[model samples]
Target: MTEHRPHSATTAMGNRHDYLPAAGRDALLPTYDLLTRTLGVPRVHQRLIDQADLRDDHKILEVGCGTGNLTIMARRSRPAAEVTGADPDPRALSRAERKAHGLPGIRFDRAYGQELPYGDGEFDRALSSLMLHHLDDDVKAPMAAEILRVLRPGGRLHLVDVGGPMTPADGPAARLTLRGHHVAGNLGDNIPRLLREAGFDCTEVATQRHRAMGRVTYYRATRPD
Candidate 1:
């Protein structure tokens, strides 16, 4: 998640929507990076990038790039690839741009997931991490559709996020705090269903208990040629 500004920006489709701040509040935005890192987000990001299998000539997009931690990692991992990060929050985009400074073939854009400014079939792969849960259930489907629309034939969407209910394997504190009231019903099953409905062949690649996020899952969604 990224920090929100007082003003709103219109999407390419002329739709205006408010964005959730990085930490769910403007006051906590500064701690978003630290909190995500503590929750092992960096490791998950690396796994997502590896799953994307970036090629040197590939053009990739990172939705909800926030502070750009994952975006920077992907860019560095494949320096020859073109990396574009899209987020609605200007503050977060600023942080991302600064962090990604001097990195060739990488840029940050101020845009929302459901209304990306890019042309159709502009990207080879799209990456998202811990972003879907922040979206309202209704928005998730359209967001998936938009991602599918932006990806070229045979392109893939790499994602990792809260999947379903927590278990004893997750820390007791996490089980208590990560109840996920805002999480969609049957998230583990629903995400793939949404992607498939959006015309991608989707699969749950992995699942694990996180120290802070409860049960998390990884997905690989490919757009058919």
Candidate 2:
């Protein structure tokens, strides 16, 4: 169930600078790992799996599967499930493939969120963990559309990212911090809105706080059957 494929150029529309620069991203892998560990990434991913009810034949897709940490978790928790990890960074995908060696039902692809390389209605579930904050402002809706396009009717979508509903008092402060990071910061309850606009029905929007990443939202949505 594992396959490796080449990527195209246009797929990287907005996320051409996932972490500022390509070299910086490759160099920060270890640091990012450390940060995740300190921020209780395992518990976060476990919550993600708990939110998803995987079946014997569920085919799972992990968007922005950096180093495949969440991807590995999903595969291990549901060994029978078919799991495919997609990312635009070949360096990250390379590490993901290396980490998933000998693991059946887990694969990696060099693709972007706005341009997934799969057929329509090919997956039962799709998950994005702590990666949406890296996307550029304009790519949000397009990425959601691609997710919806590749999912079958009634397929589920799960997203975990840094940002959520903001209060009137939070408007200015949030926008300032977001501008500094070159990320939209979502400053609003944006993920669910984007998914809803892309034809998915959002069922839940939960929040958690991290010492370093601030407020993070967990979105659970489903395609209309």
Candidate 3:
């Protein structure tokens, strides 16, 4: 398993300019594909995919789809399902679009997790992976509400993000990382409260070791029927 390193100080600073030079971006296309493709197949993603119970008639939305790693995997997992990948990063979207080009029944869009452009009750399932830690509750709470608004009654929302007990040993490192970018609020402690406030019934919550030193936590909930 690849270790999940903290983003560079520049990326941590949230400076879009710090990402990479255009030439560097061009160089990373192949690397991005390899990483996302491999990561998307792991047990964690498979669990979320199973929970989604995708069907031919389902309209699935993937927020912060990044380079469409999970988007393509989702399509492959449920070939007949309609899948859309949304991300605020144009560069990432471009890469995802290219990867999705020859694949039918899949699309990419420019959108933020906090503000989705789709209609009300337009989707059967909404998903996000590895994205929440980058946002605070002000952004994530409203985004969670928006996910519910667009989901059909009884539809599900599957989210995977970083949340765990930050030990005293981790405290200094975690704080250093936070100086550059906001880690997703600790959903491990807050997800249940947030779900109830959003009017969704929490169906499941679990944590698993992701790689060597990091953990992946998930929350699966449903809109009331």
Q: What's the CA error at residue 76 for candidate 1, in Å?
A: 0.1
Per-residue lDDT of candidate 1, residues 22-62 (tens digit): 56655666898899888888899988888889988999999
Instruction: Report the number of the highest-TM-score candidate.
Output: 1
lDDT of 1 at 105: 96
The 0-to-1 C-alpha lDDT of every candidate, in the order given, reads 0.80, 0.74, 0.69
Rank candidates by lDDT, best first. Answer: 1, 2, 3
Compute the lDDT of residue 170 as modeled in candidate 2.
43
Q: Which ten residues in a row have the lowest lDDT in candidate 1?
A: 6-15
Which residue pairs clash within candidate 2?
Answer: none
Model 3 residue runs over 4 Å out of place are: 1-11, 17-42, 164-184
Tell me, what's the RMSD of every candidate? 5.0, 4.5, 6.8
CA displacement after TM-score superposition, residue 9 of candidate 2 (Å): 11
Badly placed stretches (over 4 Å) of model 2 are 1-24, 166-185
**Model 1 TM-score, all chains together:** 0.88
RMSD of 3: 6.8
Can you give the TM-score per candidate against the true fold?
Answer: 0.88, 0.83, 0.77
Error of 3 at 79 (Å): 1.4
